[model samples]
Target: MGKTLVIDLEDVILEGDILDVGEKNFGIIYNISKEAEDELSLDYVSSDTKIELKERKYDACTFFFDLNKIWTSIEKEKLIKEISSYLKEFGEIFIWDINKERGKVFNNKIKVILPNEKIKEFTFRNLNVLLSSNIEEIKKILEKYFEIEETKAWEDVFFIKGKKIGTKVNEEEKIKYEGTDYSN
Candidate 1:
């Protein structure tokens, strides 16, 4: 199968030129954003990524965030559940935050306050994922769905990589990730 990569439009790609690498290596590129459909066209006109403006499916997806965007425990759980539904099985999901350590603590606090049903439905058990935060409670939630492959902290960001327990199984489900593009 050809490699596919999905990126959030508001991500650091425009600033860091990360799209250059994905364009070179992946066969399909999907840009997801809350912006009007063509809003990002100008930004990518000169890039080699051959941006697929009409497609939404992808084998991998990336999200960059600040903990402040998630104000409540329920919001956090909803965000996770929404994103998980959009992912392909064995798909790689990357969540990055500059203050990831603080995010770890925030995640744990929210987990304690949220309901078990909310947590269970949104669990990330079907994909290969990397999270910038590393609170033990957050790790426990991820471990329920993925096999912990690695854990490390670098340049002030804590990260964990986990591979899904089985191969792709839920790709047939139709679920669109909601919320403002930059925020989700």
Candidate 2:
């Protein structure tokens, strides 16, 4: 990937697909805000050296960000392989919260928090993208490189909504919350 503008779900839209499938606890909680920068203070990832913030250290470290790394009914290792190849040009890559304990280092290694409730796994990467402001501007900037394909999380939620079973919400739920619908 050449240039990418990563977005936090709560920052731009509702919650992002990444957090939905992530480990939850350590993934990175986001709140609704129209301001420039909020609590988490995340930023976007791009191809160029135009560093927006001074905290981004391009050292020999892996990048970890929320980018839809859930393995519910389908296998995500293949997706990770594809994305990993794309990230090789940039550097080592880690996604979501493969580990836990926010700033807590373990065994002298930068553990990647997976945000999972049951098990906390560690990876050798940190997050490269951390955008949390100006969605329209970020979208325009990202479209140049990443051919973002908008896909729903799980399809089984469509038939099992508000009932007793599936908590999964389909496009209809998204429409109800977004106040607008898109051509799916």
Candidate 3:
């Protein structure tokens, strides 16, 4: 099962270069799924690690903002839920979120906001991030829509992968991720 998962993820590539350590936005995906019986979980690995993935083909449709930077959390959650409805069962969603442990990076950040017809450069880190992409909070929401595979963090960003959990599975059920270069 471990080898199978490694084979399955050999083709995932994100927007940022995973190999570049300086690029804090991306990191290698790990197989953190627990064993049904007695299998081991594969945490995210790197080149210096015991195992390394060689091939990568990212089928990603990256959308950073739903409406804008100033949207409320309620609106964001609503949009995520709506989007979740359209996805096929067993489909996966990869998300990049701000890392709370890396909060120091935002210490000097500021933004412009409009409140009561007055413009003010204020708000939490200028991003007004809801829950600061908190993993537990994200889990609370995503768990309703997906069977979370794993959650991991890098320097300034954290990544989560979730597989849609359907009520039933059909032998013909299939979902494929398509990147910009995908060709049938």
Q: What is the clash count for each candidate, in the order shown?
A: 0, 21, 2
lDDT of 3 by residue, 1-184 (tens): 0110011222343332121211121222321112111333322223363233223312221222112232345665675565454444455666645444222223222222222232222222323434244455566777776777888754444456776666434322433332344564
lDDT, candidate 2, equals 0.27
Ranking by TM-score: 3, 1, 2
What would you estimate as the lDDT of candidate 1?
A: 0.34
Candidate 1 vs 2: which has more TM-score: 1
Global lDDT of each candidate: 0.34, 0.27, 0.39
Measured by TM-score, how close is model 1 to the native structure? 0.36
Winner by TM-score between candidate 3 and candidate 1: 3
TM-score of 2: 0.19
lDDT of 1 at 24: 20
Specify the highest-TM-score model's number.
3
Q: Candidates' TM-scores?
A: 0.36, 0.19, 0.41
lDDT of 2 at 7: 27
lDDT, candidate 1, 77-168, per-residue tens: 55444444434455444443333433242222111111111121111111112333434534565554455665654443344445444423
Model 3 residue 120 CA deviation in Å: 32
For model 1, name the residue pairs that clash.
none
User: What are the runs in model 2 whose C-alpha is more than 4 Å off?
Assistant: 1-69, 72-74, 98-184
RMSD per candidate (Å) reads 19.1, 20.0, 18.2
